[model samples]
Target chain A: MFGGYNRRYKHFSPTLGCSMNFHIYFPPSPPSSPSPKFPVLYWLSGLTCTDENFIVKSGAQRAASKEGIALIAPDTSPRGLNVEGEAESWDFGVGAGFYLNATQEKWKNWRMYDYIVKELPNLLAENFPQLDTARHLYLSVSAFAPIGNPVNCPWGQKAFTNYLGGNKADWEEYDATCLVAKFHDVSATILIDQGEDDKFLHNQLLPDKFSEACKKHGVPVLVRLQPGYDHSFFFIATFIDDHILHHAQALNL
Target chain B: MFGGYNRRYKHFSPTLGCSMNFHIYFPPSPPSSPSPKFPVLYWLSGLTCTDENFIVKSGAQRAASKEGIALIAPDTSPRGLNVEGEAESWDFGVGAGFYLNATQEKWKNWRMYDYIVKELPNLLAENFPQLDTARHLYLSVSAFAPIGNPVNCPWGQKAFTNYLGGNKADWEEYDATCLVAKFHDVSATILIDQGEDDKFLHNQLLPDKFSEACKKHGVPVLVRLQPGYDHSFFFIATFIDDHILHHAQALNL
Candidate 1:
């Protein structure tokens, strides 16, 4: 929207075994830089959200356009799988992939973790020549009302039981709170904005727990509790510029 | 979203003969202003839009918050009237009031002209004490793909036929292009931004016709033809900052 071209592309995903669509916002090439390619910022949306939510609502493109960064928004989950009772629940199947690789055979198509972490990057590097893959930054691991410590929440319990089976160890593998302690070699400071007025603040989202884990692991993190804000795109839109600027500085733009 | 309170209110409207809903974006009150009331910018949306479209999509709140301007977005047309076949067409019926008073007996409830022009302001001044009614400015009369000379366009013709009893004379009363020549005492320069790539640019919009009429009437106008843009909220979000700044200057903010 802000002097950027937002393009959508559909590609068959080998990981998810279903066709996926992603939206990319390419800012106008910087005339000052010798390199033609722009840095990347990938937005991972939360529950019940597709690739279009961030592209349409976040208002992050204004700052991304100003900083000469490209934004890639991947679909939250595989669609049209027609798995039995997949479309029934808002929290478990379909849009609620939780960005985790499924351990269960029935929910094997819910491999968003591999799709986002491995396949999507390879696809971007191979196909999108205008993107500078080296200078990439993943912002907002999960947008509004993020499951900070998913393994400790009911949402995680329900989705994990269905997708990952009864394995506690497997659930911890996908949990960022647990991963922060295991892989504490993270160089950059993780920035998080949690809305105090969010309905899921105490129940689904436990940002303080993640912050404590990060502190114990010696990983630098900033979790700002925004007052009078809710778990809506409105809250995201308000602070999107600051988040984009944070990424820009981390990318040394 | 942008450090502003977006509040939605519903009140009975005598003009429309139905309950009406309108959204208002109140910027944080300027500490410097002697009077607490803020200058307002009224946004009249086009077809298939309600009070929420601009509130959710345009991202104008950021600019309005910066400019210390309150934004008021009224419903496009009266709702829940239950007139036979009122909900039939997407363009002519429910969402498309054309901001004109209806002359036809069946569509007598569609008095958006009186509602917006006379009743809304009074309602705001009486109910919303925080708004300065005197320093008000109406921006984007018919947001995206505006029917400039509505009397000539097919959309306008159909809408006028049903709402105004197939009379061309009644159509001229609400047509901006037609009214410009009759009441050209506008002191400030009118600014318009039309997407060049909009599908309805030449057919339904007809911006040049409005510009020509404004020229003939000696009313100052600036029509910007935005390239590679289309009839979407993306196009609005791109140039909303410029439009807000223009209004701020005109209001001497």
Candidate 2:
């Protein structure tokens, strides 16, 4: 039994002008041996999530540790900001980052995409050198109950308008369907597990659009419509073992 | 693979005079046949914790499921009441029940002891007959980082003074050391895991007093001093497997 160990770190990001709270879990490894570099599975949470949400609630670490795969759960968006009306709403501004760089003028400094895609990985590699493996390291993003068409939905619309302004073309980069269709050189298979009984179904979270786009771009997609499951982490926890193996196989670990 | 399932229920408790939220997990029992009754491990959280604390953070469900044992985690204290200074301090009122019935005139109605020991079990049996076992069903209270002498510690001193009033006699009923000495009919072997490096050890929480009292009473007590561990749930998660197995063995499951 490789006993699991979790560390909570405060990372100062120049991109967001904030000290971010991120949790990194290292599987039980021997103390004497040089720590083996492991593949990472980045679990991006949906709305109203801190770095602790998935790390604490979802039992992902067991499968992760067993597979010798490291798991990193980051806060959905930048937090503890006193910017006007930030604390009032639950969805927008703080906890609802759509994982995109803001193109708008006012919220240009809210570079969550840069922090997530670039800076956070660099920080992880720097702080925990045992995780440093190769230059070709890239994350396979998997969200349990993710926002699909962020540019159109009310929650996403407000966040996009506030973060990326009125430019429709600029908004394409943030939307999953738009981004996937445009990008090439994709290798890893994308897996999407949507609950059939979810309240977010039919609208709000359009998983079909993302799947269709992936299909069109020759990017292998595995979309599993799980029956009688809702949008809670219970759904995620139920399928977490499969998800870990999915990533492990994708990374060829 | 007994796939685990967790259900969070808000039961209207007659004992606490409030709707209490408790988390119960049914280990992956088989789908067919009359569902087998599983031995329960009643896990009581430490100071300043809710029912969600251990269930969400401890990762005990995995082990309990593996052992075919059920787990019931009740809230640290009843919530949503405006009892003067109840909302003020973290240690005194809301999150701190000290796992005992209140005797003070003001807090006479605070029957947390009855809720945990009696009412909650009845509700579980009434609602889910699969949990109903022998008539003389007893709970094995295994605590990790628990308050040893509640009546003596500073945090417990404040709680006891308010809940049980100035009566030292009333305070003894709540204190573990005093309760163990007085009560001769201890059915289950008490299992306690104390972190050696806990900050609460130097003050606030003294494990030795309770252990000594249990030894004097000829009660079977297993006190494990886990080295290099803190008071956080991470510490509990590290040793949760052993704790689950400890309860499983005590119940003879």
lDDT of 2 by residue, A13-115 (tens): 8988888988888776646555777677677788888998887667777788778887888888877766777666887767877787877665665788899
- What docking grade does candidate 1 earn? medium
For model 2, which pairs clash? B51-B75
Q: Model 1 scores what on Cα lDDT?
A: 0.86
For model 2, residues B1-253, the per-residue Cα lDDT tens digits are: 1256778889777788788898888887756644788777677776678888877777777788888888888997777767887878888778888778987767765778888878987788778776744445555656777788877889878888898888888888888888888885776777788888889886977888888998899877888988777787767876788878876776677
lDDT of 1 at A83: 96
lDDT (tens digit, per residue) of candidate 1 on A1-253 = 6777899999999999999999999997766765578888888888889999889988888999999989999998999989998989889898999888998999989999999999999999999888988644463233345698989999999999899999899999888899988988776678888888899999989998899999998988888888888998989999988888887787778
> B97 in model 2: Cα distance from truth in Å?
2.2
lDDT of 2 at B206: 87
Q: B72-174, model 1: which lDDT tens digit per residue?
A: 9999999999999988989977999988888889999999989999999999988888888865445333234568998888988999999998668888988
- C-alpha lDDT score of every prediction, in listed order: 0.86, 0.77
- Model 1 steric clash pairs: none
Alpha-carbon lDDT of model 2:
0.77
The number of clashing residue pairs in model 2 is: 1
Model 1 spans > 4 angstroms off: A32-35, A134-144, B31-35, B134-144
